[model samples]
Target chain A: MITVDATGLSCPEPVMLAKKAAKDNPADEIQVLVDNATARDNIVRMSRGVSRTASVQESGGVYTITLARP
Target chain B: MESVTKERVILIVCGIAFAVVAIALAAMGNPKNMAICIACFIRDTAGSMQLHTAAPVQYFRPEIVGIILGALLMALGTKEFKASAGSSPFTRFVLGFCVMVGCLVFLGCPLRMVLRMSAGDLNAWVALIGFAAGIFTGVMFLKGGFSLGKAAPTRTMTEGFVFPVVALVLFILSLVTTLFVASAEGPGSMHAPVIVSLIGGLVFGALAQRARLCFAGGLRDTFLIRDASGLITVGILFVGMLIYNLVTGGFNVGFAEQPIAHSEALWNILGMYVVGFGATLMGGCPLRQLVLAGQGSGDSAISIIGLLVGAAFAHNFGLASSAAGTTPNGQIACIACIIVLFAIALLNLRKQSA
Candidate 1:
């Protein structure tokens, strides 16, 4: 699993970083942590390319999206 | 805050925040429908800085400073303050400049376009149509692999703090020279009290920063993903504003005699087309640009500077339109901006596809 803490980053940046991470480690389940909904939406959109399902977990205002490939 | 889901709740909050802020600003003495206009405020700020000699719209707007401050404070507190730049800064600048020019030609940015429509300005309908069409065109380019490249993180965090610091300096300067530099006449002369305006700006800056509220982004999202969450926020704001206008007697239907607006329908449409296209290419609207700058994007800062410079150029070079009608120079400038933006889109988008 690869964790990318994108907490506090704005839109496109979070997605961009997550895309880079997903591309770099294609086999691993990438867990992206973000604090805002817009970033969450964008990250989910980007992750849809490589993964069919995204498991989401929330705690203390942070969103953790786990993208697992089929 | 934790209860905010990625769906409708965030959109509702953003909608309510924008609506409440717009109404409050209007009640406190901004122009009738234009409680907070990014492009207009930037133009006024430029005039106040003597970047342009447009006397009527010259005033150092506290809202402009407050938006950056609010965003910076939030970003820093959240530990998300990453200073970054170098994503085709010059191209972003040109896009920003073109966006401002288009807004000037139409006398409003995307935010103002919505606000104007909410206030029952029928002409805004034309502008809105033009905006959507322009976005449609940009989306076609995106389908062809349009991109501005990714921004790299800067070496120091201090780079991200620069814009907020500059805002603070500007606010202090406005305070000391209140009587001298502040506009004594024109639209710039009419303003909400400094404290109220600053507070209004702060609230909006914080909310928008948090929610990533952007008009252009909303439209873009609607086009790209069948998701209407952001567009719903905009719609809710329109409803909120409409209710407020109705309650406060601010609602007046028909286009003629609207304050600080023109009746030249074609120019208004073409002008906003330019704004919509430029903003699409830049990846955010004028308001979003301000928020991004606050969050430590140096590229956004350059774009903001471009907006200011573009405002200055609009007025100083007689490229800005007036309440009476569009100037020949303004029309010519709008055409030139469209051509330049198309050229940029073709050059960059083609390179990416290759």
Candidate 2:
């Protein structure tokens, strides 16, 4: 599992960071942390582009989204 | 399916309404060649502030303010207000700036391009072609995996209301500040009254939001994915505007002496080429960007900032052309913008080993 910290980042950055991290570790489960809904939605959309299933869990204004190869 | 159908209807209705009001405005002395041009108006507004002292193109436009306030009211009513910012704020700003530079060179936004052509300004033909080519280039980048990252959702009330608030402030300032001067003549002087223009803007904003109308997106979808929903809206707008111009005796086919336009064919096309490509890459047209900002898209707000600064630069340095012809510095600015844009594209590309 590879964890990418994207807390406090805005829209495209979280998705861009997650995408880059995923590209670097093809088979690893990538966990992204985001702070906002739009970023989460965008990451979900980007994950679909790469054939990854993304699941989200939110706690205390922090969102943890895990994406893995499907 | 029902929702999608309703969306399409909204889009078409908005397009037609925009055409009707735009044509009516033209007849009312707004300008024959340009009924609604956000970029041109901004440039003119910049001049009004004596930002560049470009005479004959200085006027305070109420339509811009109307676009924001109208959209704000609709969003508030519809419960779609949300404000948030993320993504590379500076990068979006640069893209906005480039978009303005390119649009000014072409002398209109994508919306105005169609209106100009439909009015028989032959120069618009070149612009349209160039715009398509630009969109094609952006499509290439998309195919190659160009992305601007994502936007995280935020507090619906707080995030969404920020831009509208700013717009409201600007509208209020527009009324009180004699600092922002209006043009005595030229395209800037040609305007409909505040009430009519504001209502027109409100109608446009409501319909556009409901329909997802975007000029560059319309062309991009057509070329890349063979999608026609957006493109159809453009078609309706052109046809509607054409008929209205004819009925009102506003049609003067041939391009010369066209309001807010120039006859430089090559530049007209290439300018929009840059604009179309840049706007597509950014994921929306200028008007769409404005609407997005009103709806609390932080990235879009950054883009708007870029647009205003770019307008300042265009007029200050003489990059923007006028009714007379293309300025000498205009060509230089266009070439420079293209070179810089390509550089950004190259840098943003993912490197691959051969």
Instruction: For candidate 1, write residues B1-354 as lDDT tens digits.
Output: 233265468668878998998888878888777789999999999998889988899988899988888887777776656687877999999999999999999999999999999889988888998898888777777656567766667788788889889888888888986632657787888899999989888888877877778898788767764445568778988999999888888889998988788989998999999998888888889998998899888999999999999999999999898888899999999999999989988987644311
Q: Deviation in angstroms for B242 in model 2?
A: 0.3
Give the lowest summed-lDDT range of ten residues in model 2 chain B: B345-354
Give TM-scores of the second chain, every candidate: 0.96, 0.93
Give me the candidate number with maximum lDDT.
1
DockQ of every candidate:
0.17, 0.09
List where candidate 2 sits over 4 angstroms from the true fold: A1-70, B1-4, B154-159, B350-354
Best model per TM-score: 1
Best by DockQ: 1
Q: Which ten residues in a row are the worst by lDDT in model 2 chain A?
A: A7-16
What TM-score against the true chain A does chain A of each candidate get? Answer: 0.90, 0.96
lDDT of 1 by residue, A1-70 (tens): 9898877554544665677678788888889988655677676765556564576777855789887887
Scored by CA lDDT, what does every candidate get?
0.83, 0.76
Model 2 Cα lDDT, one tens digit per residue, A1-70: 9998877554334666788788889999999998655456557756766879899988865779999889
lDDT of 2: 0.76
